[model samples]
Target: MSTTTSETGARVVPIPPPLYYAAALVGGVLLDRVFPLAAAHPALRVAGLVIACAGAGSAAAGVLAVIRHRTTIVPHRPVATLITTGVYRVSRNPMYLGLALLVPGLGLLIGTWWPLVLLPLTLLAVTRLVIAPEERYLRQRFPDEYDAYRARVRRWL
Candidate 1:
């Protein structure tokens, strides 16, 4: 799916990252609730909470960087500038990475193994369905800058 913009032309990403996260969260919860796993140890739950908080922090930092640069946060919209600062410096797709982190973290928090098992599926979907297209758009839109950034930073860290 694609969305057209009169300004930047058309956007390749149809479903946004948030929606994907939401779906994964709901699916994981339902799976865990139905299947039921042994509850996670208290220590594990604490670790998961910490990890989830870190992921959320990373995502927020990325968004703040984009906002600071005054760029469009919407995936489909044309980017005003390439953000290479803050958490972005560490991961090319920090927001996506954060969302990816969230899955297993949430699973651990809920004391279920299902979400952890399903974590890779969410990453796969986001990588192929979302990040790939965004990378293509960035490459086309800001070839030199994006190429440099991509060469320097890992896709997810």
Candidate 2:
């Protein structure tokens, strides 16, 4: 899957991280139908909304930063720029972080427990399947700049 684009062509991952999150959401929804594990508490539902909103805000900030820098947003395409401003200052993987928050937040909003349970596995897959390769590509492409940025920013916050 990592060979979807090409090492020289675009440095794309085999499967995009968003698909992992989306699959988790769908799987969780299906599992909830069978298991019926609800979020239970109203407070948890409220928290879910807040967390989901924060996740959205984080992802959007990252997107806006990319747009401001005129960089490519698709992970399956070449990264024309190495962004280190806006949300990138706080977390190198803000969009991924947002998905992390969003899935479980949505699970809670929908009164299901399966998505939260599935999150860790999804993140693990993403880290290995998507982020690691992207980081390697960035390191290869940007060298000193990426190293400095990697040192300055956390991967997830």
Candidate 3:
């Protein structure tokens, strides 16, 4: 999807990330269902809440940034603007970063330690599969401009 509104007449939709995010959440939920995490250890309840809240905050920041930019955050879709200001300055892929953070938060909240393993995997998937391809596309689409911006900013800060 080219960001040039003229190239793609239809409005861009937010592209969902890879299957692992959903898979991680579902697996976490299922594990919690079978074992029921916080029933025995009340202390974990507090920790879970904090982690989930942090995730929510990160996700909210990404969503707000997207809304402010008035474009899709998904890299596969064409980006109307580069959006180097604000949150974009900190992390090139905040939405994916936020969602990556969210998976562990969910696992933490559910008290399912096993599913938390997917946290690193989520980052790897986003970096290698999702973000890498999108970066290449962006570079091709916006060569010099994107390269200059990339030099200044980190991909996953």
Candidate 4:
């Protein structure tokens, strides 16, 4: 069953957690470009590249998971098929996790330590405002099957 927005009757849109993470990442990038704090350190540059690569890798893995499941990765209305293999086995919200990873990577790339530190708060907000509710809905919608999957896998990995 599809979800709907109350007033508009539009399908309830689940905001992907990556959006916020990406926003933060972009912001961090801009800040770094404008501020240029990490440019002086060769080690920091290497670290930033590593972090950025890791973030890209995580996002790619999530995308592969979505394709493998043959499901829409939209946060609000997940596909009817329940995915339990590949990256889904590790994290119920790998896309979110990947985005989570991405923010800090961007921050590192930008040499903004504060933004990197803020990444956890961003994840917490997405989890509380979006992911948790989605989990509750999925629980109600799929019941036993979702519960089994939930039991076996972590919400974030």
lDDT of 3 by residue, 22-75 (tens): 777787678677866433356655666676676667667877877888876555
Residue range 1-157, candidate 1, lDDT tens digits: 6543324622455877877776777787888778886456998898789878888887888888988999877887778788888888899988877777777677778887677777777788878887888888888777898899999999997
lDDT ranking, high to low: 2, 1, 4, 3
Clashes (N, CA, C under 3 Å) per candidate: 0, 1, 0, 0
Task: Tell me model 3's lDDT, rounded to 2 decimals.
Answer: 0.66
Candidate 4 lDDT over 30-89, as tens digits, reads: 766676545336676677778777767767887887787676666565465667777778
lDDT, each prediction: 0.79, 0.85, 0.66, 0.69
| Candidates ranked by TM-score | 2, 1, 4, 3
Instruction: Give Cα distance to truth, residue 121, candidate 3, Å.
Output: 2.5
lDDT of 4 at 147: 98
Clash number for model 2?
A: 1
Candidate 4, position 26, lDDT:
68
Best of the two (3, 4) by lDDT: 4
Root-mean-square deviation of Cα positions for candidate 2 versus the true structure, in angstroms? 3.4
Pick by TM-score: 1 or 2, better one: 2
Over 4 Å off, model 4: 1-16, 29-40
Please give the TM-score that candidate 2 achieves against the real structure. Answer: 0.91
